[model samples]
Each structure stands twice: as structure tokens, then as C-alpha cells.
Target: MSSSASDVAPRRPLLAGRGLLWEAVILAVGVGLFFLFPYDLGFLSRILIMIVFVLSLDLVLGYAGVATLGQAAMYGTGAYAAGLIAIHVTASPLLGLAAGAVAGAGIAFVSGLVLMRAHGLTLLMLSIAVAQVLQEVANKARPLTGGADGLRGIRMDPILGLWEFDFIGRAGYWYVLTVLILVLLFLKVVVNSPLGLSARGIQESPERMRAIGTPVYWRLVWIYTIAGGIAGVAGALAAQVTALVSLEVFNFDHSAEALIMLVLGGAGRLYGAVVGVAIFMLVEHVAAAVDPFNWLFLIGALVLAVVFFVPAGLLGLPKALTGLVRR
Candidate 1:
């Protein structure tokens, strides 16, 4: 191997050595904490769903180098699709979930084409516009989506024909957790695949990748669509848990929150998304409990601290500490 290749190869093992271990640790802690808390399982379920949502953002924003603020559009689409399908078509949770994924992928495929053309602030603005349009559509399509009233009467069958979701939300918590793990594993595979490498290459420099004969635009389109599908799954999860979908599904705050989670945990790392959600939700809960209005102040300060001190994100801090310790 070339000297540079040899140098790079050694570094690969260090990155690999603890990623899985760290994931296991986090997952175990999440499960343990869920059981330990006297809190409602429904709340835990929401956090789990958010993890999937954040991870979806990580795929596009972190891996594919797509900076978008319109993720909620796809999320809301999947949610509504799942909710509508359950209410109007089939109550089977599986089928409703599929519908949501299809809806998300369909929208992403179309939007990615238009979004791929722009970059930087222009791209961000277009994404926001797309989300806003969807939110407006959801509002105007009152009869179908229930308008401001929201979609209700969604009844889902017991998951996998075994576990029934109840008001206590035990089944929902476990169900969402299982789904999150599966999605994370699937994403890990995708990111480590050839396609993911190309995405990284595209992110670093589309011009260079194109010169090397990579079909940059198409790659982006596919990646964006896949990310959308995942986000759709997250929406489906949320819809199933809440059994309600509304114009709020398309809310820009949803996208903004997901972005914050992605950044808080650290972009480029999948598990960072999960950690970000955990911390964000924890802080949110604590803050709201202490003072509803002042919670924002605490969160704002926390975010600023992370940005200034841990720019790589919370996930990066552990590695940084470990490196320092070793040195």
C-alpha cells in the first residue's frame, strides 16, 4: 500500500473499534432509563420517534451534505399519509407505515431535483418555502386532513398481531424503540456502503467527484429520497403513537427541532442524532417542569455552549476527551 493509504488504514480501525460498543452502551442506557423513570411511557415513545426523525436528518444533512430546513414537509407528509390510510383505508399498522414511507419517498424524489440545483442560503430558503407550502396545503385541505381540527379516529391494530398498544404506552415504547434500532442498523450499513462514500465525496467537492466520473446529481437525488423515506417512517411512528395527525405535522418548528437535535448530537455521526434527541428531550422536560416560558432560555444557553465549546457536537466531545486522556 502507498504510505498515505497505510496511514489512513490504521486510523480506520480506531474509528471502528468503539462505534458499535458506544451504540450498545447508548441503547442499553436508553432502555434502562425508560424502565427506571416513573414518567409516562408515551413520553419515552415520543423521544424514540424523534431519534428516528433526527437520524433521517443526519442522513441528508450529515452524510449527503444536504443542508435542508424542510425535513418537516416530508415528515408531515408521511404522518398524514399514515394517519389517512389508517383512518380511511386500512387499520393495519404495517400497511399504514408502508404508505407513509411511500409518501415521503415520492415527495423527496420530486423535491430533490429542485433542491439539488441550489446551495447555501438559497437552498435553505427553498427548503423552508417547500415546507411552508405543504403546511398551507394541509391547512386548506380541511375536509381531507380535517384542516385545523386535525385527523382523528385512527385505530391501529395491535403491533405484529401480538402486542396491543394501550393508554399506558408500554407497547408503543417498545415498538418505537425496536423500529429505531432497525433503522439505525440499516442506516449504518448504508453509510458504510459505496453509495455513502460517494455522498461524502460529493459533499466535500461535487466538482472533483464529477471529474472522477461520479454522477453527482443522481447520487444526491437518491440519497435525499432515501433520507426522506426514513423521515417518513419516523412520521409514521409518531402518527401511530398519537393516533392523530394535523396541520401541525407540517409545522416548520418540527424541522427546526430536528435540525437542532442533529447539530446538538453532532452531524455526520448517526448515534449522535439519538444522543441529541435524548439530551434535548431531557432538557425540554426538565425546563418545562421548572418554568414553561423560561425553558427556552435554558435551552438557548445550552445550545450556545455546545456550539462554542463542542462544535463537533456532544458525540465528538467524548472522543476528544479520550484522545486527550491517551495523550
Candidate 2:
């Protein structure tokens, strides 16, 4: 006899308990960082924003198993969309953020029509091409995008017309932290949902999933759209806080760095995104300060060490170490 749905429902409480534990850990870490880096809140805020970006990428490449290097396409599109909205339409930060997310999702949905069909090297190249095309279009629209000089005159109203964005960045930090927490919570629900399980199934074996009557292609496109929206939120946050948007937002480096951070923290685990961003950004900041002439070498060495030693990424370090000790 097959088990009823009610029989399996009881197991969710245990999973929810674990989710609560992780949420508490995240809250503790965020609170600790607020106190630990009072003097460098601006830099810390940037890390928080990147954490959002990396988290979005984790959703696509890690959970959805969509091998992509053009996530910056969605990111940059959101940035530009938010910046333009702020400049031309409304001074409302929230509205700009919404616009950014919509733009990202819309673009992703359109692109995924073609992108989700390809695989391997072809998929990677096509993703890269999309970003390049967007970059070129932004470049050519000199009047609209401000060309190489970057998008300026982006003024945002005080958040909710109450808390003013101050020089110390306390408001921005708290604002971003709140948004990050909310997004993380939403994603926790998503990754545990039936759709998320289907995504995992597709990732593990697309052929098998298809044979089981699953719509693998549409599932990917949906996840990709959702991921793009999340990435757009990150870009919107950057634009709102910085009060400027630049062409560099579309740069390939952003996409590459995000992927590295995801891998470093351990893809497939949501917390890995946060941990990876924190570690990578901290390392990059210190290394660049200490050896501005050749900081890349230090970064490269660190990545290599992680790859060779902690194949599961930094989140797996504890297990890796435990195994070594056992040996």
C-alpha cells in the first residue's frame, strides 16, 4: 500500500527545525558583523550586496544545475533598469527595486527560451554572448546610459520617506540586511517546495525526469527567471545605495567573481553563498591592500588551495578536517 500524504507531512517538522537553526545562525552572524565592523560598514554593505548576488547565482547554478557564466546579464540589466527608473520615473527606492527585478526576470524569460535548450560549451558560450551583447548595447546607447562616463543623477528618496541614507551607511546596511534576510527566507521555502524537488530531479537526471513526464525545460526557465529577479534585487540595492550606476556593472568580472564565491562557499547549500562572499571579499580586500601589484596571485593561490584540499568548498571544511583527523 502507498503511504498517504499525511504520513509524509510529519517529517517536514524535523526539516523545518533544522531550517530554524540555520536561520538563527544567520541572524547571529549578521548581528555580530554589525558590531564587529562598525568602522567599515560601507565595505561591509558592499559584501552584503554581493552576498545577495551570489545567493541568486547559487539558486541557478547550484540548485537548478544551470551552468551559466552570464548571470551578470541579469544583474546589469537590473542595475540599469533601476537607475533609469530612479532618474526618469520615480525617486522611490522601493519602486526602483521592483522595476529592476521585473526587468531581470523579463530578460531572463526571453533569453531562457533559447538558452535553456543548449548544453555544455555551447550553453556557456551563448550565455557569455548574451552578456557581451547587452554590454555593447549599453555602450552604444551613450545618451541614455551615459556611455563610458557611467549613469549618474540617480537620486533616491529617503527609504519609505523616513530613514535617510547617511554618510556612515548605517541605514543602507540595515536596509540591505533586512532584504537579504527576507530573500533568504523566501528561498528556503522555495528550495524545499515540490518545484524545487523537481528541479533537483532534473539536475540529477534530466532524461529520467523527462521519462517520468516532467517538463524539464520549463522548470529550468522558471528557476532561471526567479534567479534573475533575485540578482536584479542585488543590482537595485547597489544602485540605490551608491546613487550611481556604471557600465562596470555589466562587466564579466562580476559574473566570474560571483561564480567563484559560490564555489568557494560550497554550491548547493544556501549558506555557502553567504560564507563564500564573506571570505572572498575579505581576502580580496586584504590581499589587494597588502600586495596591490600582484593581488591576483594571492587570490589564485587561495582558490587553488580550496580546489585541491576542500573540494566541497569552505562549508565542507569541517567534514573534510574531520575525515583527515580520522585518517
Candidate 3:
């Protein structure tokens, strides 16, 4: 069951015409929505942040074939790092984000050293353990983390000394949108790079990749670290926008829901993350508004429908339908 590079890598270069067209479409849609929902910036920002978070997951569980339920480890660490820095030292959002990224990458590198060695159930369990440990530490360190009550007083300075974080969130919306675009563009490059190709090859078969002189172990760690940094950025964005960090950021539900979003969108296709998050969040928002207590039922039904009807995920429906047509 060997998969070729052509099979795993994107068909077209990221800078190709088609790729640029896709990027343009995303930009247009984002800007259009910005105008359409002038008042729901908070919600929009949440979706965008989740898009980034899930995008990071795609790089690991999707591209690298590393399936684990502990991504919240990096995410929670990033949020706390950003919040702590904002409270104790600097209020510069950019600085806080950098601190968050560094903290996430730091944790990922250390943990990946060991977790990447384990596979199957072992890997999954170890990943969960890593996150649980961090969560417990955060919970106990009440003096610094504010414990279960959550970390507060995360005031942020204006963006680059120009835009103020207005009460209505107009400035915050644009800030998040800009960062999201940058993340998408950066991942586009990563997905097309030599490292990216090696990661995919490793995913198909680590033993084969190792025989071919591909540093399989290091590749996994590298990609996982990169994913951690991105996840951290997402957490930082959440902390900065809300001006608070909470224990729930590390909840197992966060990682589980993110994995579900990846499944619904179609893993490995980077843009699929965006499509999945947008659809899932919109459904949840509407469902919760209509029936707060029963929203989970709607969400569960939607998940079941997607799983049974679109096994390849909603993003793959077009190609799946085309195959059936030809048959």
C-alpha cells in the first residue's frame, strides 16, 4: 500500500494559477463576510481561530499521519503563555503571540522526542498523558494561572501602535483576519516544500522512508513542532481577543472536537480545515440559538450524516461524485 509523492502532495504548485485562484476565493469570502456580519466579529474571530487550530492538526494527523488526542497540550500552553506575558510583562499582542508560539514549539519538541517513538495505542495514550499533565499543572498553579477560575487581566496594546482594540471588536476582527491569511499562506509553502514531501512519504510507510534515507523520526518531530507553533498562535489569538485564558482551553473536548472537524472536512487537504470549521461552527451557532440544551443532538446527527454519506468528507464530494458519474 505504497502511496506516491504525487498521490500525497498537491497536484499543482501552490503558486500555480489554480492555487492563487483558490487563495483569492478565500480572501474574497473572508472580506465579504466581514462586511456581511459587522456586529458578529466575536463569533467570526472564533471561527477563524479554530480554522487556524484545525489547520495545524491537519499538518500532523492529516499530512504526517500522526493520530493523537492531545493537541490541546500545545494550544493550552500557548494560551497561558500569551496571557501570562500580557499580564506580567508586555501587552504587545505580537510579542504575546511570539511567546505563545515559542512556548508551544518548546513543549512539542520535548514531548515529541518521546511520544513520536510510540505508535498506535501507545502513541495515543502518551499524547493524552502529556496534555493531562500540563492541565493538572495549570490547575494547581493557582497563583500564576489563576487556577480553575481562569487567568484574567490580559490587556493588550493597540496593533502596531495604530488600531485600538475597540469594544465592538472591529480592530480585533481585522487583526485576526490578517494573521489567518498569513498562516494560510505560510502553510501553503510548507505543504509544497521538500520537508513536507518527506513527511508525506514517511506517512505512507516509515520503514520504507527510513530505508530511503529519510529521517523519519526527525521528520515527525519537525512537523509536529510546526503544528504546535500554529496551534499556539490560535490559542494566543483566543486569549488576546477575549483578554482572558481559561482552564477549558485544555479540555479534552477541545481536541476531540477539532479532530472531528478534521474528519468532517477531509484530512490532508489543507483548505478542507477551513471549510469544515465554517460549516460546523455555523451549524452549532444556529442550533444552540434555537435549542441550547439539545444542540448536541443536532451536532451529533450532522456528524453521523457526514460520516455515512460523505466518507471522504464534504470537500471530497465533488471528486467522489465525478467518479460515480464516469462509472
Q: Please report how far candidate 1 places residue 122 from its true position, in Å.
A: 1.1
lDDT of 2 by residue, 1-327 (tens): 565644554455424765578778877888788899888888988999999999999988888788898999998999999999999999988899899899989888899889999998998899888888988898899999998888999888888998888888888888888888888888888888888788788779999999999889988999999999998899889998888888888888999999999999998889999999999999899999999899888878878888899988999999999999999
TM-score of each: 0.92, 0.95, 0.93
lDDT of 3 by residue, 25-134 (tens): 88888889889999898999999999999999999988898998999999999999999999999999999999989998889999999999999999988998998899
Clashing pairs in 2: none
In terms of TM-score, which candidate is stronger, 1 or 2?
2
RMSD of each: 3.3, 2.0, 4.2
Q: In angstroms, how far off is 279's CA in candidate 3?
A: 0.7
* Pairs in steric clash, model 1: none
Model 3 lDDT vs. the true structure? 0.90
What is the descending lDDT order? 3, 2, 1
Model 3, residue 122: displacement in angstroms? Answer: 1.7
In angstroms, the error of model 2 at 32 is 2.8
